[model samples]
Target: MAEHPAYPVGLRLTGRRVVVLGGGQVAQRRLPALVAAGADVVLVSPEATPSVEAMADAGEITWARRPYQDGDLADAWYALIATSDPDANARASAEAERHRVWCVRSDDADAATAWTPATGHSEGVTVAVLTTSARGRDPRHTAAIRDAVVEGLRDGTLVAPHHRTRTPGVALVGGGPGDPDLITVRGRRLLAEADVVIADRLGPRDLLAELPPHVEVIDAAKIPYGRYMAQEAINNALIEHAKQGKSVVRLKGGDPFVFGRGMEEVQALAEAGIPCTVVPGISSSISVPGAAGIPVTHRGVAHEFTVVSGHVAPDDERSLVDWPSLARLTGTLVILMGVDKIGRIAETLIAHGRSPDTPVALVQEGTTAAQRRVDATLATVAETVRAEDVKPPAVIVVGAVVTVGPATAG
Candidate 1:
């Protein structure tokens, strides 16, 4: 008999009983989706993988720790017959069939009442692909098609112009630490939907090239100490574009609130009576140090880590940081935008009681192709920066934690 085309319909499994006959790789892969759908999942397996066991331990699923017994699918709305033993799987599938419950069999798809589709999601849409030919099943082809559609939707390449919804507002999106892939999913989606993008000198610059031609890209040269009142100009631009009924994105490097003046932009938008959304990005404060093989806080090394802006010298009246207090603590110090003033900052820390021999690691262009790490001590960091010709957009880590992981050649 020829295989009939499988009817595709989403099952609303919320609060429904889902019986999984095996807790091996197949069950481990499928359980999360079941749990996410709010299904009451029960597993009947003599043994399970560590990951599946962890789910049972975390109260996400009920584990029977036994073989599939008769009537296991009596109350189940749906069942997965995936036990290693073909006999056990067939028995469970027959029980499901008798109870009128839909079942999927990992070992025998044709013997099951239901088939799992290759699924991917993007921006509120779920893409599920299935190939139903009995002798020509190609899961890889289905998955590839799913991935292509999802990727296109995510990057705005396959946008439906007729059904596009335009949201007019300013969004402060943190693009993450210099890497496009490091950006948050929401941030990337907002950028795809943006009509006007005002981008900073830092953040994922490569993403700009992927935008549709209709998008107006403006270079926000808000480089540190470059121009006075550049932030005011950016704020005004955001207000102006949003008032014109355009979706605007202020793409900044690292987290917008982490010394990126994100709150100031929010306040400015509020004063202008315009709506704004702030999407947090991965901060370089800790990520950069970790990327350079330095943990901000290590076991028995440093207990606390403090992130501070080194844009201003310690002696500068505009500075609000307490060098003496920071020096007294034996925690890690992560400084951003302080490469130019590192010499003065190091001296201040030493004068305030921090050891001159404290290890320091400067990660430049972190999380990007141009990334490089430079090592030094508080006493020689100034000279190291000078000798190495390290530029801006670097994260400076200070503490014994810098020496925790395998040392990277500076």
Candidate 2:
């Protein structure tokens, strides 16, 4: 990841009055980084934390202990805000834009023209994790990710391909876990184009808000974890709507192929002679483990991965799987809908000679904005989940590699 020579590097904020218009932990966290980079950081807020005041008292940073002024951005080459107030952050972003200054709006990364990477330092070895949403992209998510990365400095791990696509038509978009914004660009684009939006109830309401107002939002919205319409009814509706020349968006919570019946719908669409596309959204199967800070694949931990569905009734022959082989495979195993059948599934594996204490990560709402992860050994996962009341739409990852989640997840 080299930069072009013409590209600007970090600004020379050293000794320059770089204004920070907030006083919370974000400011506290950024202050040390700014100082380490030699920026003369001036915190301007009505209040601050104990650490902030401590820094200001020891000549570590300067403070403007009053309300923000009209021209707070004067002589500021760089600025940042963490006011926890949307309107204030908006004003700060607008002012920075007007001043033609390099700014990092912590609250709204999308509004800023530039950003800071998630950097980690260990005994003079510093590593920074950056993303495509680095500059003027989804900054809020990036910033939060950056912060999490920094907090996990001691646990610096290499990155892997999450596998994203930006094609047109419906991707059976897997909105990761509960976070609507986690949906891929391709998935979002299809939603915008959908004339008829047929979604499962598990799909978040805020995510659906991205659709055009006139789009017909049909809630064939199945909640497998909860209860709703029959599967045949939902599949038929997809064909019926697509046949009408309407761009049908069959929205699934996580990647459609992962227990979401995305393949069935695509097959049905093909049979109906409707042009269909499958956008591979982030499946909660793997992503849930990730959301819980567990990696489905890790060096020496797990080498291969298999995604399976336990939601399908065992009466269906296709639902029957080679549990014995799976138990023998030296790889990570992610099971969707295996939560309800945790006992039977685990028993099958154990009977097939798999270890009883294999690490299992149970993630609810996998990658969504609001996620919950429960780490337990294979021997106790079923009981742990029941005790936690962990619901469906959750992912159960099994193997040695999954142990990394709780330690790695923020």
Candidate 3:
């Protein structure tokens, strides 16, 4: 006779006692979600992975240093059997059954009465997938489906009207390094609920295009450029729309605080008494070079890396960059918005103390499908830039680290 299909339901494990009978890979993967769900997890294992040990040290979960013993599942509401030793796992599962606690067995799913479903959450909605039938399908297929559904929800392809709430406020979101997929989950969720989005040229423009038709999209680059006119207009726009009960999203590329003038906007909004929330994005200073296979700070090659904006010419009296001091550093140098001033910047570095033979890499439109890299020595980089016609929105890396290893090459 065949067994009946198990009934699927959500478990509210908040502050509930949960026992994990192993501290290996399966336990490592399951611990995070259990902790996140507010479960008081007790892990029983003689030895554990470094990560599990770290969690125990951090007080997120209680760890039993010794092996699992009889009555270990006493008073436990839920238990997981995931030990490498089959005998130990079987004993733990049997004990859990005696205590009337639901048990999940990683070793033999068919033998276990409870089945863990593939789960994912987006914008306050949790999605769980499970195969109740005895025909053993792959879990990877279920995970892939879960991922696709989550992506659709995040990118606005899948609509859940109840999940969206348009509160009057401003969100300063970092769009990450040019990739639409790189935007943070919270950022994407807020964007989906936004009434208006004021976006920069370098932000995740692809995401802006995916916004609902009713949502207003403003081009930040097209806003009038002046000492204060453009910025004031933006501030006023944010305040005015928000005051009218519209949720505004101010989206920029990379981290808003990293040379993105995010603080100024925050101050401006505060002075006007407009509510604002900041969602940090991935900074391109590191991601751009990394996209081109460059490590800003390698263990043996470079101990530190400095990121600077090269929009100003090296000889410009108004420029604040300390070129001579930078040239003296032995670590890596990453320059943003420096394509046009590469010639002068290179000249200044060489004139100071940096070697003319220093390896240099120019990554253009990094982290995107249009990404390209130009590699050359400091002395010849200017010529290479001109010959290759390297464009703006590029990252310039200088130091021996460029050519030293598998990192960004020169």
If scored against the real structure, what TM-score would every candidate get? 0.91, 0.54, 0.89
Q: Any runs in candidate 1 off by more than 4 Å, and if so which?
A: 160-164, 222-228, 271-273, 405-410
lDDT scores of the candidates, listed in order = 0.91, 0.71, 0.89
After superposition, the stretches of candidate 3 with alpha carbons farther than 4 Å from their true spots are 1-5, 133-138, 163-165, 225-228, 405-410
Q: Please write out the lDDT profile of model 3 over residues 125-208, one tens digit for every residue.
A: 889888765477578988998888888787667877765465689999999999998999889988998899999899988898
Worst 10 residues of 2 by lDDT: 153-162
Output the number of the lDDT-best candidate: 1
Residues 1-410 of candidate 2 have per-residue lDDT tens digits of 34322233546666787888888899888899888878888889989999998999998888999766658887888888778778878887788888887777776666676667666654244555455543335545656765665433322222221254323333355654567766765566556656787787776567676555678887774423334446767767777776665667777777777667778878876776667777677666666676577778888777799987787533346677777788888888888777788877887788787889887777776666667777778789779888888987677888888765346432
Runs in model 2 deviating more than 4 A are 1-174, 222-229, 312-318, 405-410
> Model 1, 1-410: lDDT tens per residue?
67688889999999999999988999999999999999999999999999999999999999999998998898899998888998988888888889999999999988888989999988677899988654688888999999999887776677745365666899999999987889987898889889999999897999999898999998989424347878888888899999999999999999999999999999999999999999999999988888889999988999999999999999999999998899999999999999999999999999999999999999999989889999999999999999999998899999999888998845
* RMSD per model, one decimal: 2.7, 16.6, 2.7
Candidate 1 residue-pair clash tally: 0
Clashing pairs in 1: none
> lDDT of candidate 2 vs native?
0.71
Clashes of 2: 11
Model 3 Cα displacement at 410 (Å)?
11
